[model samples]
Target: MNAIQFITQNTQLDSKSVANTVSLLEEDCTVPFIARYRKERTGNLDELQIGAIVKFKEAFVALEKRKATILKAIEEQDALTPELKSKIEQTVDTTVLEDIYLPFKKSRKTKAEKARKNGLEPLAKIIMAQRTTDLEFTAGKYANANVPDEAAALEGARHIIAEWINERTDIRNQIRTQLEKYAQLETKVIGTKKDDEKAQKYQDYYDWNESLSRCPSHRLLAILRAESEGFIRVKISIDDDRALDSIDRKVIKSNNACADQIAMAVEDAYKRLLLPSLSNEILKQAKEKADEAAIAVFTKNLRQLLLAPPLGEKRILAIDPGFRTGCKLVCLDANGNLLHNETIYPHPPQKQLREASKKIASLVDAYKIEAIAIGNGTASRETENLVKNTPFKRDLEVFVVSEAGASIYSASKIARDEFPNYDVTVRGAVSIGRRLADPLAELVKIDAKSIGVGQYQHDVDQTKLKTALDTVVESCVNSVGVNVNTASESLLSYVSGIGPKLAENIVNHRAENGAFTSREAIKKVPRLGGKAFEQAAGFLRIRDAENPLDDSAVHPESYGIVKQMAKDQGIPLTKIVRNTAVLKNIDLKKYQTETIGLPTLQDILEELEKPGLDRREKAKAFTFDQNIRTIDDLRSGQLLPGIVNNITNFGCFVDVGIKESGLIHVSNLSDSYVSDVNSIVSLHQQVIVKVLEVDIKRKRIQLMLHKG
Candidate 1:
């Protein structure tokens, strides 16, 4: 049907909201802009709902384009009929459209084409009609030079009938429905790959059989991966007798010899054409389903990790721990500017504990370090102990930060531009420190896939994954307003409308003209037009702006509303913006205009309550049990503290003071049944788990929730 009708049929969203959202999308309004600013027009649709509408509309448009191409092709062949054109135009499903186009599709010479060339059409028609007639007599009527005898004519006729059965839309659709409900996936290991080390990782999938419709996404992806790598052969199968019966019922009419010949043609069509084509189609559909599920999981984990608690602006010392290479250290100021860098060896090769301790103390005193952030990598536990034991001038909060993509960031082009003279080690240390101070700001510089908190990140569709992760990053960045004065180009890139090019322009403008004094100054950046300004102004906060509302989530377009409210209340704008008591009593209905609704006004009131408030929680220092340092140190039934590092459909991976993170399966996430792993545990949640099984040989550990 139409875009609106298609989207409404697929989604449970309000038809009016979907229509408005589709209209705004057609006008090229971004999702964030509509969700945040145009509440009145979209019926207060959130970004997620708006995004879904845009997705569904795009899918429908693509289907329409494909339909147009097919209709034109069939018409060019002089084979298009009025009824067929109506079917193609009215239908939205791609599979149905393809089936209707199959007969007209040009292909190389096949048995059906050859049979028609051999004057066997009359015999094929006899078979198709399934009338009370003698097959030899019907075949004799078509016998010619191409068809030498009655038997030869009968064979060619059967081939033509087989093709006709294959092209019928009703029969194909019936077979597809059966496959969707009953198809099973089976994998058999290649004899030569059984002993290969890489193949061993997928041993569980070898000789596996499961219902394709019921298999978990992770398991399906894993099996598909193994099959792709030549470790196994995956096949989709169903009851052959039932499939033959389905085609038979669709074609066979009379209980005679002609009907028996039609039945044989159905079997031939299934064996030669229909079965292979539909099996591949079903596999592609299953793989796409698995990809979507994996991408959703990846996006959720990335969102939680990006929005993890931040340890607000503070001078800090960060360490990248190592055994043979010494711990690389850097001191950063409150703004995350690198102030000092050094290297100290306190473990293994050097073991100069006193010397390293004195160096750290001196650096802390000299730089006025408020916190210490250590990377949880090789020798992380030992370095943490050393830092905690060392005497300093003030009480310092020590944090063990995940160093998943620190090295990638260190060697990145952004890092090179930011710190041209610093080495990778120094840049890595700085990243660890900055991530603790602000995760969204620091992690934006690194690729989400490289951040290493996903399931099947590499296996999913790359385009879909990138789009999803980019959306998540944008959401988190906009959720927490950026400081226009001090945010780096990388952090500014994720702002609602100011993408990479504009973010760099903003950084250059700031460099040339000094810090932005007001939100208005942003429009002066090169190539940042009015539309970009409208989309990004509210999310960019100026701490000491001339206009008090500029520092909050209130958009510039609504500044007059706030000022009017202040004038009506007989108070200065500055005082009224933060005066909770006055804001509480204000009647928001008085300000409702043609453009502004209750939803937008409610958001403005909330912003006034807590201006420029960070949505993330405050970072707290977490410590693993002192007794546990390595896998060798873990014992069964010992309770220990851990952080959920990565979550998958099956379970979460927790770091419990060892290089090998332990698995807490979905079953053990709590005392109750957990259908969803994320509902129970977040990316960085602190949990108390008891060691269940630790296999030192495999470097694997199993953990369960601590009862106490």
Candidate 2:
């Protein structure tokens, strides 16, 4: 009907909250802004709830546009009637709306169109009435030069009846319901593709049969991918006899020759028209559901990876490990600025252990390195061992970082701009080092898909995948407030209201005018209007500003409120901040206004309690068991330390100091049924798992979570 009614019906949210959220969205207010700042207006809805409301609002608008297009098309054909127009206007379901307009749709000549042209409409109508027992006489009356004889005329009449049966809304819905609930997806392998090398990955799905409704999303996507690659043929099937019987009861009423004629038309309609169209429609709907599920998995994993523990502001030495190419090393300062670059060969063709050790010790002493990070790639384990054995004057922690998207970032334009004189190896080493210092800032420069944490990423819908990932990145960026003076353009671009162009402008302004002194100084940037500032102010932090509140999450609009709290207590604002004793005793009711409710007041108190606190955990160093180097070394029932690198709906993959990661199926995750894998383990979490089975030939390892 309308935006408010449609969204309310679909979501079952408070109509008033939905109305206010829709209004805020129409005004170009971002989701983070509304969820954080407008608590009183939206009934204190969270980001997820507000995001759902936005989705339904967009769906309602798209539905109305489609209705307008269909209504205009019907009127142009001179087939618009009062009853038909009223039905089309009142319908909300897309499928039902299309069914109402099917009869008037323009198409190429078909059997029904040819039959109507041969003056067989009268004969078809008589058979449909089911009261004409003498169908031969009725058919003879319509016989002409075009029909030739009674048999020919009857055949044409059957074609017209079949089309009428196909166009009936109730009949189509009945068959659609059957397909939706009871259809099975069957696949058969192609004879020539059975032994093909590229087709072996999908061999399990080559000859498979499963209920379409019960099939998992990951399995369905795999089957569809195999069919598309020409390795198998898939068919969606249902009980033909049962479906035909149901349709016969609906169309045939009289026990005579007319009834028999209707029965033949019903079979033709079910076999030739209804089955093919509805089967494809049902398959499309299933694919969409699978895409959404896969996207949800990707979104969750990306968020966890983006907010992974950061080794905050540490001077570090990073290495991109390799064998014959040697290990590429880069030394970075506390702010992640590169100070020195070189190559060291501790293994393989060179075997210059003495020279490599001396270089590392010299760099640590010269650059004041506090930690060492090695890339988990070609020769990760060997490099880690070397770093641990080397004798240094001071104690330094050795960390192994996942180098999933390092190569992609090394060749990117951003990397080129950051390092104009260095080669790709040096750039990659720097990425590894920066990731150890602060993961959120460095990972933002690379693409999410290249991060290597998703399953079936290439097969899912690209547009939907990008939208979901972008929303997650934005949510994570705003939740952990950004430092205005130190954040890169990539990180600043994900702020509440500042997009790519505005982010570039902010960077340029900072370069020319030096660092931002306070929150008010942000307004001086070009084209950053009042609305953008209002949306972006709270999420942007300034360190060591003249006003102490600039570094906190408190919005500029509420600065007066914080000052009032301090003035009423007869103390400076600095004393009230981070003083739990004083902050806990202050009465929040005295500060509440018409626009500011208890929720806003509580948030202000919370911010004052811990100002400019990084919400991420501190990074800790992990060491893999040296005895286990490859899949061949793993033994059954042996427990070892590991880290969760990727997650999916079915299970999670853990790395146990080898190139081939082990799989821990959902069944092995715990004793109880696991509906979600994230509830148990997260990305980059240290876990201990016991080896259940190892297939050396296939390079597969099965692991079970070991609590003890």
lDDT of 1 by residue, 372-392 (tens): 999999999999999999998
Distance (Å) between predicted and true CA of 206, model 1? 1.4
User: What C-alpha lDDT, on a 0 to 100 scale, does residue 623 get in candidate 1?
Assistant: 96
Question: Model 2, stretches more than 4 Å misplaced?
Answer: none
Clashing pairs in 1: none
Residue 478 C-alpha lDDT in model 1: 89
Please, what is the whole-model Cα lDDT of each candidate in the order they appear?
Answer: 0.91, 0.92
> Per-prediction TM-score, please?
0.97, 0.98
The candidate scoring highest on lDDT is: 2
